[model samples]
Target chain A: MDNKRRKFLKMAGATVLAGIGAPAVVKLTSVPALASGSEQAAAGHGSGHGEEQRTGIRLGMVIDMRKFYGNEELLNQAIAACHAVHNVPEIPGRKSEIKWIWKTGFANAFVAQSQNLRSETVKNSQFPVLCNHCDNPSCVKVCPTKATFVNEKNGIVAMDYHRCIGCRFCMAACPFGARSFNWQDPRPFIKTYNPDFPSRMRGVVEKCNFCAERLALGLEPACVEACQGTGAMVFGDLNDPQSEVRKVLSEEFTIQRNAAAGTRPSVFYIV
Target chain B: MIEKTLKGKPAYWIWLAILGTFIAIGWACYFRQYVFGLGLTGMSRDVSWGLYISQFTFLVGVAAGGLMLVLPYYIHNYKAFGRITILGEFLAISALVMCLMFIMADLGQPLRGLNVIFHPTPQSMLFWDMCVLWGYLLLNVLCGWVILTAERKQVPPPKWIYFFVAISIPFAVSIHTVTAMLYCGLPGRHFWLSAIIAPRFLASAFAAGPSLILLACLVMRKYAHFDAGKEAIQKMTTIIMYAVIINTFFFLLEFFVGYYSEVPGHIHSLEYLFFGLEHDGHVYNNLVPFMWTAALFNFTGLGILAYMKIAKVFDYRLVGTAATLIFLALWADKGLGFVFAGFVPNPLEEVTEYIPTLNELGITLGIWATGFFLLTLLYKIAVGIEHEVEA
Candidate 1:
């Protein structure tokens, strides 16, 4: 731990002089913002393990809210594609606690972002929220039983429903409320069951899969297919430098949900 | 002699009739539950768990409280309870079976109960709770069966039986404490988020379970001519008195923190429970009545049990009546109204609360009937062995 910190400080000091410090070498840095490079470089002091993944394979999305057109169909298609294939149950009267995909209205969607904003008139912000599939999902950490686990292979949070005790502690820990419980037997609502996905039984929790099955088949998520070519939604490998997702992230500034949490969500919003 | 042994008593006929009737009702409800799904119940997205979950919670408490009997008999070696420790073990087995039945009825898929074990999520308290309960139930059932088999032959078996009973003491408490953790661990949800949740659960279980045992002893005297002796009942009642004191204290703690500091999430659930949340159902009406009843039950029940002057003259019939009423009152307080009140107006603050529909209530009732019917049969078989041992 001590060696890790020293390596970060040394690299951060050099970066301040390398590119960011050149223009500021003559200017007296009155404000930290003016010497942004120093701050950014200073942050590098405590981190280098991230350098390889940051440049090589740190996959992510860059969402741009300014260009959003309040396209309801586009949002629904994305959710449907994932839900349909996952065999997400739709019970009649009792809502069986399984949600592979879902949606929220625009006002509630942007309420957190623009509720306190004074100047910006944030309109047409029909944002879509999913599991966010955080790099450090708290749900996985608090599970005493480890029923919900993060798959290192695909960065997907997976559930072995058989292992879940239906105690719903993960549901309580999750700030997103993304998880749902099976309140009763789920079979009646299964109008169509997909054999591709291993189905969950009642009395356990279920949530978004992020299309791990589709990824294994070399196809994008079902939601991606529904939004394809519309330009409303973009799907690409964040790990690949040539991928469209990475290109968008560079061209436009985007925001992630609950940055304060430091979960490092893969999803992004462009506003 | 074989014909006489096979011949049933009048009480046996009555027990069989009652058990058969409930079993039939349970079967009908289960069929509909499978056909219509959870939609038949009063529960909605906001309130995913309702009456059945509450009953499960209550039964877990009842099951765990069996330790009071164990503590006296095994821990203290009280001879007054010597003839009836097996009865406590059997009661625990029945109560746990009820707990499992309630959980099954509440599940979206009754068959997928094994999923908790097959695809275990270590993160869920629900999973831990399941493990503890399964372990406790298996322990009790094994103990009861072993004792019944050995006692039927009119002799004590190997010494390992005592060791098994001793091990189950803490194991039973673990089941209920884990159940309490299921709620207390939530980040918010004011009504249940308390550090004292597990303690309160144990206290209530101790109060309610031992009270039921007192009633059980009374019934045994009346039906089977077995006297648990007044001294045993009196001693058990003292333990119940202390447990009630602790339970009421923790309950007060929950209310004080909720209303005094006045956090919104904390305050909302109380108001939702007592005064009713603006958009939610009439749980306030149903729950407030029972909350007061529970208060009355706990206070007066403890009052009667604690005071030596009043308790000396206490008839077993009156004790049985009061204890059963108190047991059911607390059951309603924590089990029924509490559950509906917890989730009504939900996290999103959508969806109003309502009593379980006829369908939902019927299904829940069906599950109870199923549990009780099974309990009756198990008791009948055990009691028969006890009778044989007495002879």
Candidate 2:
């Protein structure tokens, strides 16, 4: 080959290599850098301006079900608080019901790992499960429109109800069974309408936003606030090492709903 | 050309009236569903997809099945399929219409479904399925119309029509393969996760698609006095024989993989399908009987088709009977059994059974009637031209 051709080939090869390598290098380095920034945000949470201004903050919850083991009223209060705040409908039938957060047995919650030989207390426990708001959410991936998306700044899987075509691919794709479709008009079944949060229309999928609206208002999730008396649920930014969720993870061993699914669920349970 | 459909006998008019009544009833049911939402269907949070999706999956195969005829006739220059090529193409068009309607019926927000296009996401398989389906539909309409129009004028088809015919061969394969990908690409759904799904989809499509066309040909020969010829029927039978064998082989391969590997994820869906799963004294066996019926029909039809091929027998009655059995078998396999099988023992490891309500059935029947109505009219026009040319 001529010199000019060789130079062109080398340049072309270098361009392709740069194209592939740039993203990998950026991804590998960006996480740790973001971690430090979120730590600062955690320390500065008491400072009102810093908490609201920080980006790339992943808000998660760790629920200690044992705290409320005998107290069904507390559990109900937490669930009711979240639902009312978000305007989640209580549709009459199972076929068409919409739920953001609900309870399921330990066995049902963790299908991948074996729990057959566990104690009665552990086996019979009603664990409050919601959208894992995973680090890698399948629902966000399968949505045909950008109706469901992961916010890069905060890593919360968010939904745009207006843009959703209601194809329900996300419902099928979600392994956690976290998403729910609005089967009929939700207005009739909602006992007390929360005028603050807009009620969703029929046909769109809705799930626990981890109380994104509350987070924006510099308040903890409604469920977390409701559980404050019992101290069952702890909410904080997972990226921040100084955050309460990180301290809880450091101090105690906790398990996610389905670890093998590889969704990296934000919701952890300390049994 | 439209006048030809209008001139059919009293029997045709009666058929039209029957189809029209069902269409009307189906629309009335759909209107209720539209007002109330998909709550009217048997689908639940656990089983979000139901009858409409299953029918869509089955009809996509029927739509892609057109390639079996189009390939042999156009690409290979096989003269035997000359008469019925239009029939296959028109059959695809009708099936596609039903497929689109089924999708619309299944959507929670049919009105906002265009949001998929308004804000397209390449990451989602549904977007790709839509692209391929629409392209395939347009390709068939253009090719079928141009060729049929040329035939009526007593001239060779326009050169541009061949470009569409060539593109359609691959486009047809993509449509069903893309449809399979819609299910197969899902991460945790074990039943649809197999790599063999796309190939099996094509194989089943070939078996089901040609069988339906063959039966339609037999009906046309008897009723409309239009013969698709002995050579054509025998050739199509050979296609069905190989397709049925391959389809069965792929299905058995899945069973072997699931059973031998002994993986719980893979085995759970099949176990629930072939045998009922019991949880907390509640038994779910809705699909057990249906799955067994599908196996019986598939194997019996496979045996009959294989014997015909080996014996070199070409009895129209026997072939038509076998085709009917295979068609129904795949209808059960792809339609009733496969779609909801993935959702059994749903993600939460809880069983939620699905049984379509009467309203759902009415809508399904309406879609079928609408398909047949389109088929009747299109075939009537084609047969009229054939009669005119022969005379």
Candidate 3:
């Protein structure tokens, strides 16, 4: 009986370890560009710790609000693309609607920065705001169930809808108001169902997952891909200094939403 | 003694029936809400938390308020409070029930609430709140029941029960402190993210909790021929007066810091509550009247309290009126107003108005009915025992 009990415990430990370890191994082995000199050079921090370092990719976005100034249609298209791919519901009315990405005025977007003497174009610019996916995410920290967590592999904040208790503590904790709770069943409101992405139930909180799903598919986020020709939005590894997002940040005077809140938002706006 | 409540007068049955009708209506509304999801409520992405959360916050203080009476009787050995400690404990039990119910009603997925327990994250204050509230409830139930049992048998409560009393005092403070932490730790919510929140919650709880108990005692006296002593009521009034003063002071400190520093984020919610604010060419004046009414009642109640304190005369009518007003003042301040203030100029910096829908009100009313129902029944048992002992 003792031997059987020990054997059962050993199997359980192995299963749990395998559940966690298998993903790490798969992620490390799958990234073919791990040893590339350019990738290493771009990853300037170079806190290289062998196998684990391969998945130390910090994903971020650079949104150029200037390009979206008068083109409401362009902004809509990009938002729609993301919503469709992510299976975000369109709950008709504004109140209970689910939004992954949406437009906001420049003043509201860069809340901490001075908007007193901005040019008319800058002031009126409609910036697409979404989850900042903060390096030190407050939502991730406050989530009672660990339903929302920062992916240690890629630094992308991800949500497990099934696990969310719908407490909205994460919603309150989020300084940027990036998170939204599914106030009702989201499935019916979805215009065109995307089987690739799962629809969340009424009680879970969800936000811009930084397109972790598409990233796994080795494709750009729907928003980034839709804004391909326009170059209004760019998504790349922030860890990679040579990446497009990093380059944009380096060249442009970019400002993050609620920077003073010290959340260290990953999403930067080139106003 | 326990069976005595079952043999109440016709008036008792009528009271129960009224509460039951409200509960039935509430449950029916809740069923519809359960089917349709939280969409039935006026809560949105902007005003994510509304009436339910606000009530939960207020009621946590109410539950903690039991400690004010409990500590004096048990810890301080203030024998004057001996008669009413059972009432306070029962009140705590009922208030905790309402607090838990409000939280359950507010959830987007009520069934998944166990997720907090299954995946316990101590870093989250909500988890801590759940632990302390449940523990506090259990403590009150055990201690109150044991003491009552001993009273019936004409014996002092067992020595082991004293240990629970010692634990209950600190545990009571923790419940409200953890509730305050739920709001205080949030960095973005300038209205709630303050050091004053915990102390203010305590003060408000001390004032509102005992004010409510004092009123309940008066009602019990009128209905059940139970007098909790004039001296006892006066002692409670003193507690309420000092606590309300401190509560008012703490509240003013927030206004002072917000205005004096000239920080837009800090002052914006206060401005929205008091004078109203405009967003995108539309003005939100909905909460302005409510805030002013609350302030009026608070000061008027304070005035009455001061008069009574100075005159050295205890007038139940004036004290009762003041208590009722103070209760309403705290209710309005802590309930939807405080909750709504945090979301004003929401995360997106938009002042989208949130008015509770009828469906939401139904659920809230139902929860209140449930609390009152519990209170009435528990008091019936407690009062029956008291009557039996007196005879």
Candidate 4:
């Protein structure tokens, strides 16, 4: 119906409002004026500039080894919190993977340490693993759809499982091996549906969304809260100097996992 | 038996009953998989691809393998293959059908299988494999259809169909080459990431495919009885022998590179398969033994078939056995080992061995059964009407 009216107006030359006698009335009656009088008119012009401006809120994290003492409970708490909030699987099986967060050693544990020595065996160490939310994440580049994307809002690299086709290319491209494909539907165990995190079906790939929901709610991530006594993970806005992560990163030396890969990971760990 | 008249057979009913029963069982499992997700399959994070994919890969080699026979007869103008030429084309079509359907059943999201179609990524080898396999299938189908239609009408086909056949000749070679490229392109996989992988795949396809076709022709002659002409198979055996020799040579090349380079990633899978992983879940069952058997059969078959020209009393059986051995040997080396050797010593260089569960084996059997049924049905239509054996 709208298309027909637009065609009729186009045919009558009324589509081009500049030629109309009442320019003021045309401006007032325009879609912009109808959208939100003065504020929108000003904001719309500002939005053009807004898109050009780099977002100042560059979210990041810094891990301080001064705090960690090999506490599995604290580590488990942090991992479970992130998983719970993000609807990561409570089940621990092969075929049904629902891991938004997991664990491994410094050597085998990818992300911050792809080439760390100890390929042969372990050496009294463990680490919580999550999406580094890399500046140039390999997972994002290889995605067939723009399902995996880095948002400018807070520089969080997020995954939309609904848009995922589960080709497993993202899994292959991820230098951190952060991505996992949904080999099975993830809906059986939930007594009630959680609106915060969307459930993924079989045949789509998924990864950590970096607690975008908690960020929207103006709350710290579940991992951050659980890391309370653990002292290892220090998640905060790296853009703000006053932020704990920023302060920690500035005062202490830190390195990224597979720094040579050139992904420029956001997660910082002192290993 | 098929030539006397259109008559009834007990084997047909038994085949139907067996196929129907298995399809029903497979459908039940497929439904359970749909409801629960890939949870029904034995695959996990570590073992991402399981038996379904392996079977599909093996079947594709078997299908595209038909090109080995098709090329010598049509392209080289081997007059010896006269009556048997149609039989090769017929077997190729059935094998291709089985290969494609097996792939369809392997998907976790079988319904969204169209995503690969609707949104194809050219960079992904999966897309290219789909293209090559489909191209080979269509090319063979059109060539066979045109030729058979012309034979039925007792007239020569339009000149272009033969040109299409000419194009399909090299294209048949490309199908399995592209299939190997699917694995060869993956960088991290030490076993699959070889340069000779694609050429080696073609070599095996030629050796195994024509040998299988020759054996199938013999079976056709023996049962539901059609004289697919022995002379054509004699020429086909020649092609098979050459292919087996090339394949064996390329196989040796891979071994030389792997051993000389001493790269752990390259050597690990080979070590695990032959020498056995000194740790968990390591079974040396049939790895070295089967490999040597395949080599022995190929060597002996090549000597007999290429020398006696497949006409010697013993040559026929040796060629058939060699082809069968090559097919099964490549199947194990490529399929099961392809999956197992890939993730071993783990990508992270950790040690997590794989043991396929019973559920996984059941699904694999179900898919294989489906492929066989499809082959059976297609060959019935194809072999029944094959009067293209012009003297």
The Cα error of candidate 4 at residue B334, in Å, is 1.8
Candidate 3 residue A93 Cα shift, in angstroms, is 2.3
Name model 3 segments beyond 4 Å from true: A1-55, A69-72
Q: Write the per-residue lDDT of candidate 3 for residues A1-271, one digit (tens) a residue.
A: 3443234234324433464422222221113222221222222233434312223466788888778888878998999999999999887876887788998887787777787999988777678889988877888878888998877656678998889888899988999888888888888888899998888888789999978777665456788777766778877656644455666888999888997676778888777
lDDT of 3 by residue, B1-391 (tens): 5587688889999999999999998999999999998889989888889999999999999888888899898878899999999999999999999999999998888899999999999888888999999999999999989999999887999999999989999999999999999999988888988999999999999999999999999998898998999889999999999999999999999999999999888998999999988877888878999999999999999999999989877888998999999999999899868889898988668778899999999999999999999999999999999888889
Query: What is the per-residue lDDT of model 4 for residues B267-297, given as tens digits with 9 covering 90 to 100?
Result: 7777766665443355533245544555565
Q: Give the C-alpha miss distance for residue B236 in model 1, angstroms.
A: 1.8
Give the per-residue lDDT of model 4 (tens digit) for A90-126.
5555545567677776666652243555433234556
The sequence of per-residue lDDT tens digits that candidate 2 reaches over residues A79-117 is 999888887877776788788888888888888768768
Worst 10 residues of 1 chain A by lDDT: A25-34
- DockQ ranking of the models: 3, 2, 4, 1
Give lDDT per model, in order: 0.65, 0.84, 0.84, 0.62
- Candidate 2 on B5-55: residue-level lDDT in tens? 889788899999999999999999999999989889999999999999999
For model 2 chain B, the run of ten residues with the poorest summed lDDT:
B264-273
In terms of TM-score, which candidate is strongest? Answer: 3
DockQ of each: 0.19, 0.59, 0.60, 0.21
Estimate how well candidate 2 is docked, as a DockQ score.
0.59
- Model 2 spans with C-alpha error above 4 angstroms: A1-55
| TM (B chain), model 1 | 0.90
- Which 10 successive residues of model 3 chain B have the least lDDT summed? B1-10
Give the Cα error of residue A183 in candidate 2, in Å: 1.1
Candidates 2 and 4, the one with greater lDDT: 2
